[model samples]
Target: MTGSTLVGALVVGLAVGAVGRLVLPGRKAVPVWLTLALGVAAALLGAIVVGLVDRRPGGSPLLPLVVQTGFAAVAVVLAVVAAGRQTSPDPAARRKEEV
Candidate 1:
């Protein structure tokens, strides 16, 4: 990827990640670093998908963005779910033990 593309990926990733964090309800226990990482991954995935379909020399600038955003949405949701699974404690598993 070009330097500009790399920067774009980072920017997109950060935005996607922030959105993911916001979309999740309840307590947001996710760390900023993790969100950033998820964003980067989502951006990468989106870029790959777009690259696969966007093989033309030139075309509308909006379609790729839409694809990327769509991918970002899916990725962000999945990331949130996965993060939630890992971060959320099992309510049933925690028995009330008296000391």
Candidate 2:
């Protein structure tokens, strides 16, 4: 990918990732960096998917943007799930539960 494409992906990723996080209920143990990375990857994947599906010689820009955002949302959900699995329990909570 070209530098511009990467930069665009990053920008879109940041926005899409933030929206994804906002849509989910409850706290996520995922770090900001991880979320950002997920967003970036998702955005690129979304772009690729849209590019493949769109056969028009000159397609509308809106469709690709929407598709990319959707992909980012899916990635965020996965990231959140993974983060939930990896989060360490608080010692106090564990002790309380044991008691």
Candidate 3:
């Protein structure tokens, strides 16, 4: 990947991580660095996947970048749900119990 593409991935990743933190309801447990790392990893994984699916070897870099950013955003949300479950109490359980 070119230097610009790398930077773009990082920027998108950071944004996704920040947005994920906000979307997750509850006090922050994971450190920012961890979140950022997860985001970056997700971005790279997403980009690679997209490239492979498109049958473009090595990937178009920029096209994959956009796809990766969007996917990274989704990944962040999923990650929050998966990882945050243990740390954040489930309110739905309380509601069901109340009823």
**Candidate closest to the true structure, highest TM-score:** 2
Q: Which is the winner by TM-score between candidate 1 and candidate 3?
A: 1
Query: Over the stretch 1-99, how does candidate 3's per-residue lDDT look in tens digits?
Result: 556656777888888888888878886667777777888888877766764577756555577767877778777777666765563268887677668
**lDDT scores in order:** 0.69, 0.78, 0.73
RMSD of 3: 5.0
Best by lDDT: 2
TM-score per prediction, in order, is 0.71, 0.73, 0.63
Q: Candidate 3 overall Cα lDDT vs. reference?
A: 0.73
lDDT of 1 by residue, 1-99 (tens): 456555667777888778778777866556767876877777777777777777887757576566666666677777667766662265654444321
lDDT of 3 at 76: 70
Q: In angstroms, how far off is 64's CA in candidate 1?
A: 2.3
lDDT per residue as tens, model 2, 46-84 = 887876788886778787778777887789889898777
